[model samples]
Target: MCLYFLDCWLRTERYYELDDGDLALFESKREAFLKKYEKEIKAYRTERLIGSGTLRDYNFSSLPENILKNLDSYPPFNGYVYQNGILCARIKIEDKYFYLPPIYDEDCR
Candidate 1:
């Protein structure tokens, strides 16, 4: 099983507030986020790399509060953040997927 942090983009360096409607969007689509993104996010299962999967089957977690807060600073309502790596949480926007290299940050903590 995979652990995923469900998150959304923001516009002011604060946590983005999602109303019932926005929440519903996430709640309603388990396939979208878990689908795939070769552009960002690194996925691996066993010894092979996994590009996509089902969010329903994937585990969920809360993103770092600071990261969540930073997402709130973005402006575009339909864009993913992070310069060249996965942003941990947040939703996927493209129907296509991108493959990202595994993270090697010792300070991932």
Candidate 2:
């Protein structure tokens, strides 16, 4: 699996800084949400957030305080590696989960 350390732009109000335990909880919830509405979430993201509609070079540190720092402990992130991977963001709408780069690896997580 390929892991890219990216500048991720997470929604503050939606997803706050999650510690180790909280991160696990969030991932479990996210997995369940995906199993149910993955297709719908994919459709929304493909139409609105990726490809032609995507936002590149987005400032990922727009979150408040050390939120970003805490989120870095999540999967597929190993701190910033000077890799300019375009915007990585995760948000949920109407009880549906959506993300730009879907399916992250937890190998070295």
Q: Indicate the TM-score of model 1.
A: 0.17
**Please, what are the lDDT tens digits per residue for candidate 2 over residues 78-104?**
222212343344543334333433222
The reply for model 2, stretches above 4 Å from the true place, is: 1-56, 73-109
Q: How many backbone clashes are present in model 1?
A: 15
Q: After superposition, how far is residue 102 of candidate 1 from its true place, in Å?
A: 30
Provide the lDDT at 106 for model 2. 35
Per-residue error (Å), model 2, residue 51: 10
What overall lDDT goes with each candidate model? 0.31, 0.33
State the lDDT at 60 in candidate 1: 28
TM-score per model over all chains = 0.17, 0.18
| Model 2 deviation from native, Cα RMSD in Å | 17.1
Scored by TM-score, the top model is 2
> Distance (Å) between predicted and true CA of 62, model 2?
1.0
